[model samples]
Structures are given as C-alpha cells and as structure tokens.
Target: MPDGQSTRTAMFRVKNLWIIHLLGWVLFMSLPLTIVSREPSAGFPVRILQSGWFSSFFLVYATLFYGNLLVLVPKLYLKQHYVAYAAVFVGLLVAIYFSKPFERLIFRNFRQEQGRELRPEPPREGFREGRPPRPPHGGDARPMPRPNGERAVDFVSLTLFIVVWAVAMAIRISREWRQSERRAILSEAEKAHAELSFFKAQINPHFLFNTLNNIYALAVSSSAHTAPSILKLSQMMRYITEEATENYVPLEDELACLENYVELQKLRLNAKTSLDYEVKGQPEGIRIAPLILMTFVENAFKYGVSNHRESVIRIAVEVAGGDIRFLCQNRIIERNREEERTGVGILNTQKRLDLLYSGFYDFDIHNDGEIFTVKLKLPGR
Candidate 1:
C-alpha cells in the first residue's frame, strides 16, 4: 500500500506524463501548418490546416490505444487482446488516410469506407475505362493513397515519450532521497541508544562490586553494628535493582542512596572523622539518571574518608535556577606517590555521565591541601 507521500508522488507523475505528451502532440501535429509551413500561397495553408485539424481530432483516440500501450505495456494487450489492439490501430490509420468524403451512395445507395477489411462500392472507373470512382452522394471523386509518414511521426512522438520517461525517473529519485534521509535519522538514534546502553553496563557492575566490598569489610569486622550495616546494604541493593532499569529516577531516590551509603560508612567511622551534607532540591518530581550522584559520594568514602585519621566529608546538592547542582569534598589524607589515578569506578562513572547528559553537566575535581572534591552541576526543571 502506498503512503500519503508516495500516493501524491504517483499522482503527480501521472499528470506530468500526460501534460508532456499533450504539449508535444499539439506542437508536432500543428508544426507544418502553424509554424513550419513553406507556403507562399493561401491554398497550401488551407490544405495543411485541414490535415492538422483532422489529426488533432483523433489525439485522444490515438492515446487510448497507443499511448496507454506505451505506458501500461503488456497490461493493455492482456485487457483488450493483442488482435483488437493491432486491428484498431491499423484500421484507424487506414481510415485517416483513405476515407472518402462522399462514398456513401455508390452501391445501390449503400456506400462504405475502404480498407483491407472494409468493402465499399466497386470503383466506377468511367465504368472501367480509367475514371476515378464516383464516390457516393455524388459530392466528389478522387483516387490517391496516403503513406504512413512513419519517420516523421516517430521523430516527433518518441521525443515526447522520452520526456515522459524522464519525469517518471525523477519521481523515483526524489522518493529514494526521502527514504535515505529517514534511514539516516534512524541510524543516528540507534547509535546514541547503543552508546547509552554501554555506559549503563559499565557503571552498574562497578557500583555493585564496590557496595559488595563495603559489605565484606563490615562482615569481617563483626562489630555490634553489623546487622544495621547489612540492612543498609540490602536497601542500597534494592534501589539499584529496581531503579537501574528506569531511564530516570526521582532525585530523592538518588539522595536516599547517598544516605544509605553514609549510614553504612558511619558504622566504621573513626572518632576524629566528621561528615557534613545538605540537600535543598525539590526531590519529589525532579528526575535524575540512576546512581549518578552516588559516584561522588562513594568516591568520598573510598578515597578521602577511608584513608584519613580525622577526615572531613562535605556534600551540598540543590536545584538552583532550574539546575541540579552537586558538590562533594573530603580530605585526601593518604595520597599515594606511585599509583594509577583513574580507578575503574571513577572512569566508568565519568563515561556514564557523559552518555546520559552530554552537555548538561559540569564536573570538576580538585585537591586543596588534604581535601579532595568532586563538583557537578546538571540541568533539569
């Protein structure tokens, strides 16, 4: 089935073809009389005009049989039958050439046209002594055979045929151009979706492994706070398992993950350690990519707070001016002199953010004295 565009294109193609053919037919059949006449005498102009008018009268009839055959091809033959097409085409050509103006009263007042298949009154040749037949109705008498003039007709009509074919070819080209553009857009979307899915895969596994490691550490210590640590870890897992499937989670869900992570870390806090945090966003309806915020919080616990004797952790996040602004700072108490700085977790988290919010984020990392900070600003209304 054709869509709206294809249907419209097809209709235009049909109209264009006929317009080309009609213009060509008029120009060619009228040319000798209307434009190319070598006549200096009025009589020649009148004769050409009569012939041109005669040919113009049968234009549609000629198209009904011949033009349709050219366009519809063998379909026309199958419908009208091959013999019928040939017979009508040949008979019409012969009639245009040989039909007598007054041939209707020769054989007992019954005069008919003459052709290979037509029978008219036998020629009255001065009653067989070389006179042209007395055409019926006694209006005139003439004897002549008009040639097909096939070369002239072919030169004119085939030129019009080529124009029609060119228009159809143009329609096909335009349709393909549109289809190609649509395909290009779809391909670009698929590329983006694949990039996002890879980012998701990279971040999720890194997150789960880190959380499991925290659980392992608590399990090894076997402190009185172990049960609640296990509970917090379980809640974090629930958040991951449920919310990770979604494209975006509520901003509060991200805040809750950070809180759970902080609670679990509290079970292991040294007496000198301190944590400071604030969340001022409208957490109810605001949405964020799943697990986006926790990476900074987790980094605070993993690098700065985990290594310090009396470390400081500070977090501030709020929706300001239609933006989600996040900041995390912790003391980098134990800097390593010789080690790779790009951990798998941090690297994966960076990629996930790049995919999710390509230009919508501002991420900065800085270490001032003993404090390390990850500052992020993202946009959502």
Candidate 2:
C-alpha cells in the first residue's frame, strides 16, 4: 500500500503479461516447422529445413512487429504525428507484403541447391552406349513442380504479418492506456498528500502552542516534573520535525511518539481523569502513516478529561497475523459532544487512510451517547 510498491507491482505484471504473449506466438510459429504434407514426398526434417528458411523471413516481420510497438507507437502515433504514423505504418505493411514473394524466391533457390546435394544423378545409362542421353520425353528437366505447401508459404507469411501487426498495435494501445491510468492515480495521490501536509502543518503549530503553555505552567509552579516534561516535549517535537513528513514511519516509533504526547498531557490533566493505554503485541518491522493515531488520542484528551468529574480514556493496540488493530475510547464531556465531529485533524486522517489503505483497511467511529470510540484495522509490515 505504500506509494512506490504499487507502481513496481504493476510494471512486474505488465512484463509477465508480455512474456506470455511472446511465448504464445512462438508456439503458433512452430506449427509450420513441424507439419510438412500429407502427400509424402519429403521427410519432416526436410520440410522443417524449408520452413526454417521461411521462418527467417518471418523473423523480419517479427522485428517489424516489435519495432512498431517500441518505436513507431511512441514516436509517431502517441506523439500526435497522425499523418506520419499512417504513412509509415502503411509503408511497412506494403513492404512486408512485397517481401514475401522476394523471400519465396530465395527459398526456391535454397531448395534447388538442397535437391542437388541430396539427389545426385546416377551415371548416365546411355553414355556407356553412344547416344548422349536422349533428352527426357518432352523437354529437359522442367523445373520440378513446386510443392503445394511451398506455394502457400507466401500467402501464409503475409497473413501472419498482418495478424502480428494488428496484435502489436493492440498491445501497445493497451499498455498506453494502463500507463495513463497509473499516472492519473499517482497525480491524484500527490495532490491529496500536498493538501494533507498543509492541514497537518496547521495542526502542529496549535499543538505546540498548547503543549508549551502546559510546560510553562509547570515550570512556573517549579514542579520537579518540569524538566522531564520539557525533555518529552523535545522528543515529540523532534519526531514531528523529522519523521512526520515521510509517507510512513516505523509503527513502534509512532507509538512511542504517542506515549510522549500522553505523558505530556498527564502533566496538564487532573489526577481524577483516568487514562489507560496498553500495547498487546510486538511492533518490530511494522510501519504506519506517521501521527495517524494521534488525532484520536488528542481528541480524547481534549473532550474527555475533567478536573471535577471522573472521566476515562482507554487506548489499546493489537498486532497479530500481519494485521494491526487500534482502539480508542473516551467518555465525553456533556457539553462538547456536539462539536466532536468537526476538526481538521480528524478529516485529514480520514483522507490519508483513504489514499493510503483504500481497500486494504477498515476504519470505524461511533459516539454512543456517553462514549466516543474509534477503531482502525490495517495491514502491517
């Protein structure tokens, strides 16, 4: 679900798909090499050699097919050079058509040479007598009649050339479509990240001001906890400055940041407010969006804590089987219940989860009269 991983996966899939395409073409091409004729004059190996000669011509067609995909599509059609694209494509097709007969001539010459090599004439029977060899009945060896298979080679080559051209064009077009869609998705995600960053930037200043105020009060009161509180605040600030801008951070680091924030909040909250936090499993090698859980924790502190009334906030995180589950529950202050739904922090968190996890996670929130709860489940590691 991280940003670059999806792009790499898509590229891998496309590469595999094209490999399958090439293998299918190769299997189809082998038919000509294996199958000779029902009329049984030449052996299959001889036919295969003949087909190999024809295959050499198909090699040129294959080159053109791949060339059009890798070169022509990008340089001409995709670049909006429509007239040039049309002219070049038609020219290639015509050249392939004409080259078929040219190659057939070459195959015929090869067959003639092979025939001479394979079937030398027996010693002339009449040479022993004095009649030089009454020429064959009607004429000297008329060119051996071409086989039906050899005659069909040119037509079949042309047909395959056309078919391959069409297939290459189709694949190129589909690949372009997939690339464009990927670009659009990435663009939308970048826009969302920019907007979310701006919102988060706004949140940091306000949160720092509030935490500084709490620290100031503790310092003025000369409480012994002031030094450690300032140290905690420094650590949290360092984390926000260094790690928060990245796409993801170690889950344990994020949880440590939360612990620091909670400790700082404890310096300001009444002793009567009950806050319970627990971690249920190991967090090694796991990662999550930075500060994603802090919003809910901050909300709980902001609205659920009271100096006079007994208030409770509980947070728990569970990690198991490559899944992470987070739960935060707090009893709300009677008067602040209505305003809970509105905050830049909560809204930004929702947008981020949608962009990053989309189909890979579940998020839920509920306000049941007296208690507000948030639950998040997402893939880990």
User: All candidates' lDDT scores?
Assistant: 0.64, 0.78
Estimated TM-score per prediction? 0.54, 0.63
Off by over 4 Å in 1: 1-174, 306-310, 333-343, 367-371
TM-score of 1: 0.54
Estimate, for each residue in 258-307, the C-alpha lDDT of model 1 and write its tens digit.
88878777766676778887889577778888877777787777676543
Clashing pairs in 2: none
Global CA lDDT of candidate 2, please? 0.78
